[model samples]
Target: MKHLKKKKKLLTNDTFVIVPFYNEGKVLINVIKKLKNSFKNIICVDDGSNNKNQIGKHKLGVFLIKHPINLGQGAALQTGINYAIKKKAKTIVTFDADGQHSAKDAIEMIKLLKKNDLDLVQGSRFYKKQNNNIPFIRKLILRVATIIANFFDNTQFTDTHNGLRVFNLNFAKKINIKNNRMSHPHDINKLVSKYNFKFSEYPTNIKYTHYSLSKGQKNLNAINILFDILISQLIKK
Candidate 1:
């Protein structure tokens, strides 16, 4: 009981940074360390990682949760959300584990959420202006996705697939991520309308590293996501 209490006290954080990772051992610990500077409560959901031992070894004030198998990124994120809610977290931020996202963007997003008393804040790579370093193919994917997403929701966001988002506890309760894969982006964007969350997208400087670029979705994956959406719609019938 004493040990559990100590762990809880040490792990308790007002700002919970929830990260869903799958075979990202190379960058997971580093990502947590970077967030440690800005956030106190950190939760890393291991999505059936082969390196479960590896993640367990890193005790940097992170509450590590493990999935028995590779469910999906969306599942991992949802698991983290559940844990964060149970812990009574005041704020929750979803961060990418591949390190494509910037900690500065997360800090600014959370700050804006608190200052403006907004329920949700999303990141946009193309908001304001985009960097030339963005690959042409990657840029095209985001643009097309953004266009399709715009048709689904009234939210005027320049980037639709961005993973960096901050949610207040109240707003987080309203968010129920059902997608078990990358389709989570669409699932979340569509929910804003249903809940009427006071949401807005802010400019975030995204850094596409070689590793992230290599691990990123392909054009073929886009077709699969479209198919998935269509199937989901059909299922609703």
Candidate 2:
């Protein structure tokens, strides 16, 4: 608690937030609203949504960037990060547009990043929190996925797929999220391991509302995510 105060004093200023959404209209707005209270600079990237309605239209003090065609979440994040870098942002945050993520947790993640002078801070919902609300099948999939990630990537994180993260410009500039969709998280881990970036995985909480759960990755989709990662690496080779 005391440490958070010290970190927040420095991090709350000039912090850039990147929110990527695809057709998450109203939920995106509310989530951004909550974030505005925590940071001054916020950017929302519309990831080529098919919906006719626009997002953050009347929301003041928020930067809105949109892609013409549907790109993956990774591309949307890259777009926002590029803009933040151009604007001379020292630190940037990647947040999910869905209501699953909490602004309070984001504050802590950013603070820890600055407090430890780390390159990246990742939020892990499974760190210490009970997965009571998590569906049984979902819980099994995530735990297995975490084990696989740690085994192969050599990362010791408890949660691998949480969308909340903080990165200093040095690391942010080095990021290239080519996987685009759900596979982006895996690609980011590869980059982190490859670059040997200073990072931490902190315990965080998530709200598994029906809406958020519905938008979440299906259990069967893990197979597809694995295939995509393999194919991308194969292409690089």
TM-score between candidate 2 and the true structure? 0.90
Model 2, position 10, has a per-residue lDDT of 46
lDDT of 2 by residue, 49-78 (tens): 888535536545788888999898889999
Per-residue error at 197 for model 1, in Å?
1.1
User: In model 2, how large is the Cα lDDT of residue 99?
Assistant: 86
With a 3 Å backbone cut-off (N, CA, C), the pairs that clash in candidate 1 are none
| lDDT (10s digit) by residue, model 1, range 101-188 | 8887887787789889888899888887867378887788878878876676555678888889988898777667767888777777
Q: Which pairs, if any, clash in model 2?
A: none
Deviation (Å) of 39 in candidate 1:
1.2
Q: Evaluated with lDDT, which candidate comes out highest?
A: 2
lDDT of 1 at 203: 86
Per-model TM-score, in order, reads 0.90, 0.90
Q: lDDT scores for all predictions?
A: 0.79, 0.81
